[model samples]
Target: MSSKSINISEEAYERLNSWKKSNDESFTDVIIRVLPQKRNLSEILECLEPIDEETAEEMKKAIDDEDSA
Candidate 1:
């Protein structure tokens, strides 16, 4: 396959490296696996699993704590 080179910060490189599943996995594979696919918001929302009331409350509580801090 044809390839192109791009420059990224050391921090970005480290983050991408950490996402590698194994030494055999390439950075391209890691990026494809971790990055969201191009899709409309409605399509994305439709795939989301509904959370239970307890889980929702806990998420809200965490957000509230973050806001207060």
Candidate 2:
């Protein structure tokens, strides 16, 4: 695999080095492996708080129009 040189602060480098699984693994690999996955809006929307009163009224009107179609 291809590789490139990178500059980092001593503290940051130490952090990544501490997380490294083995000498064969690179800091880049460690970062990618630890990265969090993105979440979909629909998955969390059900838990969403209600919109403000004025916006809620406008939202109701829009939703009603959509439903009448």
In candidate 1, what are the lDDT values of residues 1-69, reduced to their tens digit? Answer: 888899999999999999999999999999889998899999998999999999999999999999999
Off by over 4 Å in 1: 48-69
Give me the candidate number with maximum lDDT. 1
Instruction: Write down the TM-score of every candidate.
Output: 0.62, 0.45
Per-residue lDDT of model 2, residues 1-69, tens digit only: 788888999998898899999999977889889875576888678769878999999999999999999
Off by over 4 Å in 2: 1-6, 38-69
Per-prediction CA RMSD (Å): 2.8, 12.6
Clashes of each: 0, 0
Worst 10-residue stretch by lDDT in candidate 2? 35-44
The all-Cα superposition gives candidate 2 an RMSD in Å to the true structure of 12.6
**What clash pairs does model 2 have?**
none
